[model samples]
Target: DFPPLLISLGDLRRGFVFHEVKQVLITDEDIFKRYRERRQRWVGEEEKKIERWTELRGGDYVVHIDHGIGKFSGIKTLKLQGRKCDYFQVNYKGTDRLYIPLDQLDRLHKYMGDSDHPPPIYSLEGGQWRLTKRRVRKAARDLASSLLRLYSIRKVIPGYHFSLDTDWQLEFEASFPYQETPDQLRATHEVKQDMENPSPMDRLVCGDAGYGKTEVAMRAAFKVVMDNKQVAMLVPTTILAEQHHRTFRERIAAYPIRIEMLSRFQGLKEQKDIVTSLKNGGVDIVIGTHRLIQKDIEFKDLGLVIIDEEQRFGVIQKKKLRELRSSVDVLTLSATPIPRSLYMSLMGVRSMSMIVTPPKERLNVETQVAEYNEE
Candidate 1:
């Protein structure tokens, strides 16, 4: 094989004659390795830029670690103690201003709360910020203690260990229309492993909208059904529950599993019959909105509970979910998880799997904002 040839664009443009031609035997693999390393470094730098909260604009709300929330006026240069320095000007409630030194930027953070409802600016003289911070710290402590207690209880309680995959499970997976992505495969495997273990499975599967998170849940639900246990899928809205019901029925049409949907859209008698069927173990899978968690609804032998868009549920619904977590396996799916769920996953308090790879035919969604015009 001939070695690769190198030519400089500057040399070619200058109309210079080359004294000699040299060739080096560098493989394509080496060039690709260097390219990958540089790409990774660039990606890391971009992530760091995103993580930093230094891009503050005027009139934006900001929160200080020492003080409470305030409105960022602008940056100003002032002389203090016989020295000139730049400080951030923040306006609090009622004509109050606090100047923060540039060196102490770490204490400033951009407010990340709901934009529709802006937070009230705190007055520095009232000392109310201190009291608010104290209450927040106490709430955090209580949450941490409760989480620890739940973890300890789950560790000791005996949970059902599912058997290995059967022939029917393999066939069901093979029937999927599209090829599975690597991340999807890994997440499915981890979920199955968790179910097979003695501990009650509490795995969070996070993926983008079209990353096949539903497929992972389907596999888990099928596994539970194969073991002669029922599955309950909870969604936030009735529309989503109906959509999931259709998808699940279409996917498992070849199997003998009975899937039912419970939503407000159904007639009162229809809903009552579905509830009755669920209690008698006639339904293998039930998909519904918050109605499924009502006091009257009961399952024969629930093995797994799948929660979709968990952030949309209210506190009471989530409390009911927590109660279910103590007994049945819970699989949570979220495109954008809430801070609490993300925190638990990061701290290893709960098993988490991320499917970051998008499917082949998925397209990027273009978002546009337009002024409303009544016609």
Candidate 2:
């Protein structure tokens, strides 16, 4: 191949090749200096990473394919060619030793396992198994892509149109059992702005459980429904959908909103009837577990989609949801971060509203820990 463009493409000099080219284009000296500074900072960060890897030792949780998650017992030193090399002694599976080299620390991660987490072990020398894993991962990615395409098509399709009015707002607010908290009010304002704005809304409402998140969602749903549009409430669990359906029915009972649920628990006849109603604008709001995403279900005027407990959704489900809500506005409510890595990657691109303050009535509980004998 020809010499790289960075080097001169001319005749050879006394000891080097030279070429006549454009002058240095460093017009902004400040920008050039900043670029260099950033590059140097990244280099320093990489050096720190390498230093950390080299000095890794005991008490650290190391993840190995065969050993899974285990605490480093200590290091074993071996003298080879007058130089000493260290190996990490990881304790796993009842005295199981995983001799990982200090150099390989880059492959490990700090294990932050929860109560339900199962210890992972090292699957060393399992090349065939890894290949199988790769194939499975690839298949899953392909399936997700297909589902996303379908969702995109659905989102682009225009659904129901809504009219702007404060009647539903007044009715819903009057029916609210408790006064709205400051966080709830802020979230409500954000959702309302998203719904009223001509541009499609894609907002995430993150907060702890029982923090009036559902109420905020209800307010948005009511607004959408009042606009002569349909709302889709997508939940990750059947139980949650049922709960939401009941809550929506109860909250909007004072209004003329017709909310329905479509889940596996319902018979085929019920699902069919609900789908028909959705297509004919008979149902004002439809709430269901991921079942709401099925191809058979059609929304007459799907204006807003509220995703509850979004962290419970898998990569495929979240992708599918995104596609379905591409054109329409989406409101995602979650306790923690979204489970899908894709959403995290696109966080800056998406709108997010966090309810950090707890409701007025909710109080923080203090806990006391003591020895059993002391009690």
Candidate 3:
């Protein structure tokens, strides 16, 4: 739960599902009064200010005061008046730009995609986005406050009733074709171990693009589905979702499993049917992009959630993903290779698996780099 705070504290602390916080008898009047006062949460102008450490960092989104929606590219240190200050460089579309001083970060938002379309670009020269920044900031602050309260209550609640059983392990292994790669075997073992543990799993399987990461997820999903439970596989793109749907359908077809794909590209009726099947337990495996996170879709018995290429998801979707991690088994697949130094820093604390070896008996492709010549 503490580690999840690094991702999103609100997600880790959201309201309880089946349990509620138990109230304690007040023993001291002053302490009780102080607690009661703290309970009346409201975002004032001072409260709306984001702390220096809590400001958006690189990889977070920032709504430009002038230009509509631009990402927080990063902060650079600058020497000014014999002192150092940080400037946030925002990449606005079509040649517009905004440079926000570090101290003014309170005026910006850690862009959570509030609307379907990218927030329209306000005229930069007219300073429209800047004018609306305060209102946006206030809204974000209110959301944060609400999130904080919700999480506080959720932290005190107990977990779910349905627990994972181990009957599917045998069937899962039997369904595999082509001997498992050593790395794949290791990852499967890690996943199985996580499933058996009481503490929820938040493991990442980092592998090369074609290094059988999906196969590992398949093994886990098979286990969950075999337990008569539903599984959700969240991809980052529509193309990837379609590809996964085909791959999963082909792989799980050997067993008595029904897999479905959900996305905007599909017909409205088809999506509705698929969603209905998901809610009624007719669909065992669901594969889609972040569209799966929408409120309309509900799983009958979601035991596991497999997220592929999670780094590609937007911040808001990722936030919801974190919310799902508390009690559900979350197996993430990352194609981006982490540097050894950075991995070392996070090694023991975060559970991770790396697939470095190619499959045995597989021939390595011969490659050569030649200078590009325009002919």
Candidate 4:
């Protein structure tokens, strides 16, 4: 017994059950120091900055600092003051054209406004656009300030720091049926990185249906289970809860992770047994409807909470969700995300990953434009 173990009570149904955690605690100074450092670490500011490499194409709409919204006409070479230079040709209302020098590219930005029913283009002489800009700037500033306060509070609170992925995790990933897209791989990497860190993660994954959002969640759940911490996936409908439960179990069938589901479909006895096991730290992951947020349910250790169809929840349910928000890792999945959700990420309250590119095997559609006819 040279290496002492930090043991706790195990299940009594099988007479004797000892669950060994992945990370071991050793008395050796070097070992203890290394584990201690991983236990309480922080992320740097450089990683928090969102990357901007937007590509603008012709026929795209744009906004100019001095001019109102307009459409891009592409680059045109011109000779000015006996010197040749490249210029971006911009088209505005009423045959008004503005040529901007390549050096002043900072004065133009992509327009993000309605196209089907766009707002009326204002005259350069009016202050209509200026007023709108002032209002938007004020709102963004208020959002940023509130988020800063939240970040300050989360920094001091410690969370369950999971160890890095093992060979088993690598094998599980390799066993995935379909090839992962680049964006999916990127999102998985970010989520895993967050789990390995000390601070709690608040991230959102947005994509259309069948874009592998569930796969990303599954990877994170598996990692947390390997660390001996429980995971909770909350859904708005009982159908979705049952669906996710089945999918999660099938994916981890090769492993020893104990998974359960909570919904009206389950009998009272079954529900009671699941809740008891969850509270006793016998269950690894629980997928359920909003009923999981009720008062009686308890978890010995909840490392991550995944919310699917988060937009469907009511205000009261949201309030209860807020109570569980503190010091706990949260992952939200949504397709056709709401403006409020995107705003939260823009304000730094949450990290967002968008998957827009479709899979390679998807068929390309052919469209031929023709004059409309009432046939």
Candidate 5:
């Protein structure tokens, strides 16, 4: 038998040792940094999928797998083992409070029980929450039937696996006049990640009117278009369609995407021509009113559908959209947050991203007061 030996052959301190042969190769800092960053992003995404739970605001109803329903009372810091740690505070029925450590958030979920209204707050005594959970779970089971059809379809149906964002996406997002809020950034990332995945995305982005919901949707739209896929944006009113068309055109000016609008403003012939272009794959993005859901409209390769103010759409239009929900990646935006009714309707069905934080900067409105004492 031969004895093992070690030898160093290169500048790098790290080496591979064999009986009499040893070699070391230095890693390039730039390449290694890029790879490390990429790996970090991938790991982050995977961690995100483990327990996808939304942030709970104070007073919002939530479910504790063991304790049933409660209202989030915010985080409180307490000294334990001579160290200060934050604990999640939840207020239950009848002056009962449950304090859960931050590490156990997975046990909690945003409560979505009973249609139109949540069950009355469960008291801590007499095991009332157990009964409430059973009743609510039953109601959820009944409502969940309508939602699972879409959920099942989404699981099997394969959507276009879009490529990652290009440099153009970064540039377009940078050109925005205002800074992107944290909620907006997360929502945009979720949208882009969904587009890159094989399964269809049916995410509902809920936010206030002045928040940056439009910006988030636009960023996703830009990503979809960058992948050479067409995008269709449905607005409730013609004025909004025009506004969005102009906004998209301006932000994506650097890209070669062709933007068009279809509303009452366009003549009947023009509408037909735009529809033709869409089917022939000439247009990259189209902004339109509710008429976009009409039977005559079609797309060549629509990868994404952005519906603004979804609550404004009528039952007929919603029915029309129901069919498309499974095939295409849909992003719905609204000024007001998703109501309990809508949430319950889609519960256990689709992913929802909310943007409750307001924008950082805005102009103030002047006000005047008059005294009518003499009148």
Candidate 6:
């Protein structure tokens, strides 16, 4: 037996304890489990909200996985078999319309093609869509085979094996202001491991904008520079090249590494001097646009090539990159990767690391559409 505890009306009024408690719960395991399940469901719904089709409006082009490209006319509710059901209305060429039930919305995707010229809508008759898909599949297969052959050749050729990180590298990374996310750390580790191996590194780092993809590339560049090898950062446009040049300079300011930018913005004499410096190993890292691939530009010992927005490069520029792929380490960074890159990564032809975790306090981008007005 123990002394009796007094219960006060003040406690009950303040919600500290119940006035007349019949039963007391000992554990909250069930409540916690339910809370977790609800949280997961909320996350799933949020992801679905960001799907491309959610923003589809009337008159927008859409592609049906089985029916090819068509124009979205909007949703409609119509009576079918004595019952009313909601269906997606899609209009094809020459008054051809398709009604897809709401249950099959997963088969539709917003059309992503050239904005200036629309793709030809496939006819629903005569199996033309099937034939077109078959031809595309064959082309894709051939492309994959060629990519595999190229990757195999790259594996056989030995590349510059960079040593592990040094004291300076640690210090440089520690100077970063923000904490590194888990995905960023993992991607950095994988890149360094690839550099340490003798095989050439052809890894794709896919992440959204402002997700520290540049930080990963900078770390790799620092490692390569530590081993007395140069790094060439190729961008798609002059503006991008300039932006990267600024970023690299700011990040490596305390170090003795020399970074130069090559674009049409530089004077003729300055361009010649930069090119000379590259040939004589005066420059450690170079960030440039397609101008870097011109006949005159040369590097003393380029061990790493970082291509930003690789999909934006044209066929000719990419062809030149393919030639370099056999010898030097290549790292491609893209926020919106093209289908070829995705397929290559999936097929194991090239290594890939994804930085999916956004930074703390980072908010989702908001998009708004309005009619263009001169004012």
Could you arrange the candidates by lDDT from highest to lowest?
Answer: 1, 6, 4, 5, 2, 3
User: Over the stretch 81-161, how does candidate 5's per-residue lDDT look in tens digits?
Assistant: 677887888898878988887777765777665667766766667887667757976976854674578768878878889
Q: Per-prediction TM-score, please?
A: 0.77, 0.67, 0.55, 0.58, 0.57, 0.66
True-structure lDDT of candidate 1: 0.86
Which tens-of-lDDT digit does each residue in 234-328 have in candidate 1?
A: 99999999899999999999999999999878999999999998999999999999999999999999999999999999988987887788878
Q: Which runs of model 1 end up more than 4 angstroms from their true locations? A: 1-54, 75-87, 101-103, 365-375
Question: Which candidate ranks first by lDDT, i.e. highest?
Answer: 1
Each candidate structure's count of clashing pairs:
0, 16, 3, 0, 0, 0
**lDDT by residue for model 4 (345-370), tens:** 87766789887766668665567999
Instruction: Report every candidate's CA lDDT.
Output: 0.86, 0.71, 0.70, 0.78, 0.77, 0.85
Candidate 1 — which pairs collide? none
lDDT of 2 by residue, 1-375 (tens): 443334332212123223455233222333344344423433322222323654556666665442346676777886666777787677765545667677666445565556475555544444543565568669878866865665556446653344554865877687787878899989888888767766677678888887889999988888887678888998888888888889889888877779899898899999999999999999999999888887788777788888887778876787678676668888888887654423642555456777788777887666799778954
Candidate 1 vs candidate 5, lDDT winner = 1
* Candidate 6, residue 80: lDDT: 70
User: What does candidate 6's lDDT look like per residue over 1-375, in tens digits?
Assistant: 323553322101112334475433222433345344423433332122215445889988888766888899988898876778888899988888999877667667777768999888877777788788789879778766766677888878898889989999999999988899999999999999999999999999999998999999999999999999999999999999988999999999999999999997899999999999999999999999989999998889999999999889998898788777888999999998877787778888789999999989887887899999999
lDDT of 3 by residue, 1-375 (tens): 223222211112123333343422223433445333433442253232346634656655565333556766677787766777777777665676566786666556555556556555444566566567668779778756754554444345443333354455566566677777899989988887877665566678887766778898988888776568889999889999999999988876767789888888899999999999999999999999888999998988888999887767887997798678656777888877334312532665347888887776766566799999998
- Candidate 6 residue pairs in backbone clash: none
Q: Which pairs of residues collide in candidate 3?
A: 13-151, 65-129, 65-130
Give the Å shift of residue 51 in candidate 5. Answer: 38
Query: Which 10 consecutive positions of candidate 6 have the poorest summed lDDT?
Result: 7-16
> Best to worst by TM-score, what's the order?
1, 2, 6, 4, 5, 3
Which residue runs of candidate 5 sit more than 4 Å off their true CA positions? 1-146, 337-348, 364-375
